[model samples]
Each structure stands twice: as C-alpha cells, then as structure tokens.
Target: MKLLLFEDKLRENFFPLTLTRFTGDLRCGALKLRQRLEALLTDDEVSFLIDSSIEDLYSERHPDWQINLIKPGDKLFVNCLLKYSPTLFDKIQTLDHEQALVQGNALVAYRSNKDHGSFDPDSVLKQFGISTENVDDALYKHPADLVHDNGRMITYDFDNFFSDKDNSFETEPGATILNPYNVWLGEGVELKPGVVIDASDGPVIIDNDALLMHNSVVIGPAYIGKNSIIKVAAKIYENCSIGPVCKVGGELEACIIQAYTNKQHDGFLGHSYLGEWVNLGADTNNSDLKNTYKNVVMHSYNDRPPFDTNTMFMGCIIGDHTKLGINSTINTGCVVGTGSNLWGRDLISGYIPEFSWGEASLLQPYRIDAFLSTAQLVKQRRQLKLSNKERSLYTSIYHRYQENQ
Candidate 1:
C-alpha cells in the first residue's frame, strides 16, 4: 500500500518554522512526525504532500524519493497533523475501501483505489470530506500544540525509535544507569564518570558517538543525537530531543534542538525548539515560564496579531543559522527568524525577522552578501561548505521576504 502524508489548513499556524521546512519535519521527539509515521507503516510506500513554498529547498535537501507520486493501487492517505497513535490504525480499520476516515471537521485518512486527483492541499481534501464538528479533535492544530504536548509525544515517539525487540545499545563503565533496559544506546557511544542517566520516568536513547561528559545528568524521556556532546555538569531534564552533531551544555528541559546546533555554554533553555545551525553564546537564557503564570502569547509574521498559546510554559523559538552573543537573554514565546545575528547587552524579546542584525531594540536589515559570508564561515567551522544550491535557496527566500515587506 502507498502512504500519503498530507498537510492541511493548519500549516499557516506553524509560521517561521514552516517557512524553511514542512510541518512533518518539525522535531517533537527523537524522530519527526513523518519519520514516526514511516516507522509504523514500514511495509508501505510513503511520500509527503508538502507546501509549495518549501518545494525547492525540501527537494534539494531530501532527494531520495519523489513526493506526491502514487502507484496504481490502493493508497492510505493520512493527515500529518495528527499525533502518531497506536489507535490510528485501529480507528481506520473499520473503514471500507474508497471510504475516507474523518473525525468531525478534518480529513483523517482514506483508502482510494487509485491516486488520480489534483494533489493541491486546498482542493484535494474537499474531494473527500472535511469539517470541524465535535469529533475526536486532531492531536495537532498549531505549532504551539507541538510545543505544548511535546513531552507526551516524546514518550510515544521514543518507543518507536529504540524499541524493536530487545532494544540495546552500549555504555561505558563508571556512569550510572537508572533502568538499563529502558535506555537505548547506539554504536560507539562513550560515557564518562559521574554521569547519571535516570530512566525511571521514561526512556533515554543516545545515538552513535554521543559523549556523556563528566558529571552530567540526563534524565529519562530524553535523547542525545549522534556525534553530539553533553558538556560537563550539564543537567538535561526530561522530554528533550537534541539532534545530531550538537554541542549542548548548561541546563535544558523539554526542548528540541535540530541538527548542527551549538549551546555549549551556561544557559537555561526550556520548552522550546531550535532550528538547524543555531549557536547560543555563553549565558544566553530564555524565559520559559512567566512570573504571573499565564499562558504564553507569541507574535509572528504569519499574521497581523500576536496569538495566545494557551499553554503555561513556552520558551523562545530560534531559527537556523541564528547566533546569539554572550549573555543574550530572550523573552518567553519570542520567535527569531533564520539567519539572524543577535548580540547585545540588552535582554531582547518579540519577533526578530530573518536576516536581522541586532541587539534588542536596535536592529538593522542584514544584507544578503554579508549574511552569506557569515553563513559560509559558520558552516566551514564544521568542515562543511555552503553549497550553491543553498545559496540559491537563500537568495530566493531573501527576495520573497523583500516582496512581502
């Protein structure tokens, strides 16, 4: 069977993050929503139905398969917005062939004999049926929903990544392991002394070449990615996902860091998401909870008004290639766009647009040439060069931003 993962109307709710990647690419746990779905449907052929804005970049970044392609057989179309649940298959099991499984005001999934229809997201769903009534609401509706319920999503996705018949990795001696069976290790994973992994609350999975440095504590429901280093005395609390080749230190809880990022300094990042190629300078702290204990309100470029998250805890969301100077502080629910450079003595908050050069109140639009030079230097530090394709992509996005302004 062919599996089609479709993005619905809620895509706009994911704003700046969705500007560079698809909704399914957002990291809620060890695996992306698309990866989590693929793990469950291992036997079927899978493809993503993403937005046109990211088509060029997405196709270039991932060239393995052609998306939106359907074979001449029954296909299982699934809504990528929903949380990956074991009951998903059970819910659709009762539906007959050619019948679309829907809740109230959304298209859950459907079985079609053939895949011959306009794949446009706006018009495709109408061919089936979609409405918002009072049925079992979709697990996801906005980007904030991903952050609000990420802790639970971590536990669910973790089970699929590490557990597949006696999931076992490796660990060095002299490190404390709280529930060995619940932890999964990848190849060549090294551990230093005075490192404690508490897996009682949930499972801990460390990927290949991940170094658990001296005196660090990583609680369960956490993940350490490949070639990543957890610096000395760092306290990584529960429900966090650190992607590959990252250097994380300080304190973190319920956060997600994409690949090739750096936070190797003394700081507190909680309940947030960091895009790829981010670098957090020393002592850069983000406020996750407010003093008044109210739901976090976030401002964005996707719309005119600042939106309410209705969640009590939320940190700042940093986009890719964004760098923060030493002691830079960010306010709660702030959104920083990609290619932004911030370093100033002030505590910054609010929405910082892409390619912005600033220190809080003072911000200047970063020129494309200057931004590309800095981006190339940052990539070179990791022994990688910025590709021509990436340069073109950035140029396109810059032009689009100018048009919007």
Candidate 2:
C-alpha cells in the first residue's frame, strides 16, 4: 500500500507554510501530519503528491523527483492533509459525495468551488478505491480539537497538556508559569522569573536551550523552537510556532515563524506565518479579522481583485529573509514575498513583491547591501555565524527579485 498525501484546495487556506511544501509537512500537535500517518501505516510505502507550485520548487533541489507528476489513473489517496485527527485514516478510506461521514471524524466535507480535478492527483487516490472529493465544506480542524482534558493534567498522545508537574517544577527568578503542565520545558532551557506560561488548557513546548525572559507570557498549544529566546514581557498565545534561534515577543497567535526570524517587541500578529530569516520591528502588527465577518480576500501574484480565501480569519504571509520596520500595521490577508523590507507608521496595503521594499503610500525597492546588513545584524543577535551557502542563497534571492523590480 502506497500512502499518497495530496495537496488539495487546502493549500489556499494554508499559505506561507504551504508555499514551500505540502500540507502533510506541516507540524503541529507534537508531530507532523505526514509523520503521524507514516507511523500508523508502517507497513505501507508512503509518499506525497503535492501542488504543481511545490513541484516546481522541489524540482530544482531534487531532479529525480521531477518525475513525480500527477498522471491519469495514478491511484492516489486524496486528503486535505491540513489537520490530523485519529479518525482521518478511516475518513479517507470511505469518503463519497452523499454518505460523506467516515466513522467518528467530525470534519465536514463540502463541495470545492475551485476545479481541483485538473491539478489534483485523482488517479493516484483512486488506487485505494478512495477517490477524491471536491468539497468546499471541508471544515478545518482547530488546534483545540486535539486536546483532551484530564483533571490533574491534560494528556495528549505523546504530549501533556497542563499538569501538576509544572506546579512542582521550580522556576528561576523572574520566571512565571501560568497554566502549569500545559508547557514542556526542555533541558538547558531557562525561564527568567517573570516568564509566564499560560497553558490553562493546551500544551506549550519550550525546546532545548530556549529562554523566556521576565514578563513573557506564552499561552497553550504553543511551541518555542530550539535555542530561541522570548524577550522581556512578550505576550504570545496558542497555535504559534517560533522557529529555532529566533527572538520573539509581542502578541502572536495562529502564526508559524520559520527558523531564525525575530518579532521581538510589542505588536498584535494573528493568523499569519513567517519564513526563515525574517524580522519584525517593534509595534509591527497584523490584522487577523476584518470590520465585517466576511471571508478574507488576499492579493496574489497574477490576480488583481484580491482572491477570496473563504476563511474569515486569514492573515499575512511573509516569505524568507524579509524585514519590517517599527510601528508597521499590515492589512489582513497581505502577502509579503521573500527578501522584502516594509516599514511605516501608516497601515500598509497591497501585495508586496518579492525583494521589494516599503509600502507606506510609496513602495521602493530595497538595496541588496541594506538588506544584507540587516540580515547580518539578525544573525549576530542570535549568535550565529552566517554560512557561505546562506549568503549565496540570499544573493540569488536578491537577483531573482531584482528582475521583478
């Protein structure tokens, strides 16, 4: 049995992270969805059938995989792959148009308005006798759904929610543990006396060498990557992923920060994702909700009328090596491409092109030297030496965006 994880229309719902890879690659609940599925299907041969966009990116890195194309009668197993539930396997095994409910899975399946048949690996999923469905009603699972509450502590699969263990655990000066047991503190990690972890419900994991300074409050279902630091008085919340070697603070929720980004100050960021080597200045915030509860509209590369994202809570997507200035307020569903620098006191609008700079009424192209200098500074703060390969990558990004400018 070959397990094929297809990148369905959920790609639009999961941007920034999905921009680089498939949905199964997304990490959450102490494990990635793909990895979890692999564990369950130990006897099967598992692989991915991702979007053409991802195929394009991975092709250059792994030439042999270029043959990994969607073909007719491919016999693929189709899944949204955005969120993982224990019952997902059964659901995929028996999904159809009329009798859609599979066992105990609560996820709703609806009709997909987009024509995914052209792009979807339909034939591949058919091999399992589990053909794909174009359902727009596929209700996304929230992080809270995975949690199970135990009176003493919440035990979730391999991870623990809030437990009495955190209560008995000692904290250094200035470290505050709000909702105990909700967070996992890895070895060599230090929590400055005032660091507050509010794992009132969900679990928070502070990986090895992570430090939370005084006055930092981290809510449940949060992950602070290895060797990262939470600066003083940072207010972080649930469903946020702070990647390794980063420094973060401010208000963040449902945001995934790829390795080595910094948002170290006071700001409100919700429903967003950031790529590697990005930085957010003090008071830089993103809007997750709109005046009306209507679906969020996002600006794409070719589409002029902001694309309908279906979800009302969509936020911004910042690509790799991007930087933003202090007091910057981003509009909902904005997409900031790789290597760009944005700043201003005013609220910024429109899609920011890759490697372009600023969006305060007038947008400008960022100088490579200036961008590199900032990148160097960020690396230094994290006490990391910039590798030649990374510098070369940045150089390539600089040139690639220069063409667009």
Candidate 3:
C-alpha cells in the first residue's frame, strides 16, 4: 500500500518553519513525525502530496514526485495525521465521496469557509482545541517527556562515574551523573570538571557543542541546542528548545528559542517561543498565565478576529530581531512582530506590529541607526554579515509596513 502525506489545510499553521520546508519535514520528537508514521506503516510506501501554494517551500529541499489524487473507481486510501499524536492518525478512515475516496475523520478538517484564516501560533491552538496547559502535553509522550517532567538534579559523586553505554560521557573530575535516566547526552559532547548535570525524571538533551559550565543544574527533556552554551550556575527546565549557537543562563522553561536567540541573563522566561536574533535583557519576565485561568487569545499580523487558543498558559511569540527591555513584562499570548525595538516600563497590548520602535507607549519608527545597530549585533553573534540583498529585502519590508506606524 502507498500512503500520501498531503498538505491541504495545515499549510498556514506551519509557516516560517514550513516556509523553508514541507510539513512532513518538521521535527518534533527524536524522529520527524512523518518518519514515525512511515515506520509505523512499514509495509506501505509513503510520499508527500504538497499543495501548489507550498510547492516553492520545498523546491530546494525535496525532489519532485508524482502526487496521486483520489479519482473515480480508485481503490486508494488516504489518512490525515497530526504531528502531535499517532492516535489521531489511527482515528482516520477513507470514505467514498462522489467519485473519489475522501480522506475524512480529521479531528480538524480544512475549513472550506471563504473566511479561511491565516496562521498565528495562538490561533492554531483554537483550531486544534488545545489549552495552553497542554501545549507540550503531546510531547510528554516522547521518551524524553518524563525527563522534562520532574526536572534535573545535581549531586557530587567523589568517585569516577563511567558509562559503558554508547553516546554517554563522564566529564571532568568531581562532576557527577546523579540521575542518568533523565539525561541523554548526544554524540561527541563533553563536560568539564566541577560541572553538574541533573536528570531526575525529564530527559535532558545536550546536543553537539552544548557546554555545561561548572555547577550548572540543567533540568530534563530540556534541549540545549547544537553548539549552545549553558553558563555557570544556569538553571534550565523542561519543554525548552534552545536552538543552535545560543548562550543561555539563569532560568528557562517550556520555551522554544529558535536559532541564534539569547537569554544570557539572570531572569525568568516560561512558556514562550522566541524567533531568530532576539535578545532578552537581564531580569526580563513574561507572564505565561493570568491570575485567572481563562482561555488565552492571540492577535497577529496576518490574522483577523482575535482568535481563541483554548489555552491558559500561552506566552509570547516574538518575531525575528526583537529585543526586550530590562525587567520588561510581556502580556500573555503577546505577538511581537519582526524588527521591533521594545524598551520601557509600560505593559503594552499583545499585538505589536513589525518594525516598531517604542517604549511600551508612544511608540514610533525605529530609525535606521537603531535597526542597523541591532542588526550588526545579530550579525556578529551569528558570525555572518547580512548580505546587501538581505538588507534590501528587509528595507522593503520596513518601508511596506512603515504605514502602520
């Protein structure tokens, strides 16, 4: 049997990430969701059926293939699955609709309503019927899920602790692997002496070049992205995905920091997803939940009608190159657009437009000087200067959105 991973309606929900690849290319657990599905149905040949609109997204990544369509008298069967769970896949069945076998039983079908909406992280939550408390709930079923649940621990083992297991490590002298069950160290990684890693229950993944400084207590199911650093005395919690080349410290939990973002401060950030090139100031705190446990709503640049996320624990979805002020407090379900230079004491509304320069109130145009300065900092951090073409592209975006000011 042949299975098709068709991209029909979930296109918008997987933007930016999907902007570079197909939805089947997305990675959640140790394996890509689509790969897991293929493994489960090993007897079948699987192929992706990408929509024409998203075809360009995969042009450079995957080779072209003939996509099958349901037609009259076709004995084909199709199943729509969610990246979050395999149970959702099992619930699907094929039904004959008109002359074709329609792939139905989707928990959320593609809304044929002319008012089909655009993508926003929080809005996707409402469509999926997800509550913020359950944001990482599906991921909890991963082998690493239990590792992120209880958090990591640090205990001194005077004797040398050695692991015969492949991909295991014993860092410098005096460092201990108190709870090995919760910690999963990737290949070719090392640790220095006096370094402490705690894996009480949740799984901790120290990816390649992920350095744990002396006495750092990193909790489980927490991913220190490839080549990132955890400074001395850092505290990292579960449900965290720190992407490549980041330098982190203090505390973090249930957060997704895309590549090249930094939280190198003594602050608290929970239940958030930071885009590329973002920098958090020292002592920055974001409210993940309200005092009242009502559903969270998020507004975005491309979305209309404030949408419900059905989640009480939704935090912020910041765009690229946005910086937060020292002691800055972001509202729940806040969506800060790209190239925003936010600084000040006032707590602004959740939706801050792109290229905005402001102090929480009385915001204005972020002049070129400020934009270039931050851009330069990002360039230096990433070890690559922005090309003139890239600069021109950003300039175009800035001018286009300048009217929003």
RMSD in order of candidates: 2.5, 7.1, 8.9
Compose the digit string of candidate 2's lDDT tens values, residues 213-271: 88788877677878999888888877676768888987777777667778888899888
Q: What is the lDDT of residue 287 in candidate 3?
A: 81
Off by over 4 Å in 3: 1-81, 90-166, 367-377, 385-400
Task: Show the colliding residue pairs in model 3.
Answer: 132-311, 146-202, 147-201, 147-202, 147-203, 148-202, 148-203, 153-198, 203-221
In order of appearance, the predictions have TM-scores of 0.92, 0.70, 0.68
Worst 10-residue lDDT window, candidate 2 = 145-154
The parts of candidate 1 lying over 4 Å away from their true place are 102-106, 128-135, 164-173, 402-405
Sort all candidates by lDDT, best to worst.
1, 2, 3
Compute the lDDT of residue 302 as modeled in candidate 3: 43
Encode model 3's per-residue lDDT on 1-405: one tens digit a residue.
344555545444433333323555444433334565565543545556665544533443354553433322222222233433345334332222211212231222121112222322223334443322211222222112211232221110101121223445667787777677546676656676666666665556677777877777776556666788887777777666676778888888777666777888887777766767888888887887887888777762345466566667777777677788788888887777678888889885677867788787878887756786679767976678765544554565566565646
* Candidate 1 lDDT, 1-405, residue by residue in tens: 777887776666676666677778887778777777776764767878877766766687789865656567777777777675656666654455666656655677766775565465445446644322223655576566776666676677667556753766545577898888778888888889889999999888888889999999999788898999999999999988899999999999989887899999999999888988899999999999899999999875656578788898989888788899999999988888878889988777888877788777888877889989988998999999887777886777777664465
The alpha-carbon deviation from the true structure for residue 83 of candidate 2, after best TM-score superposition, in angstroms, is: 2.5
State the lDDT at 327 in candidate 3. Answer: 80
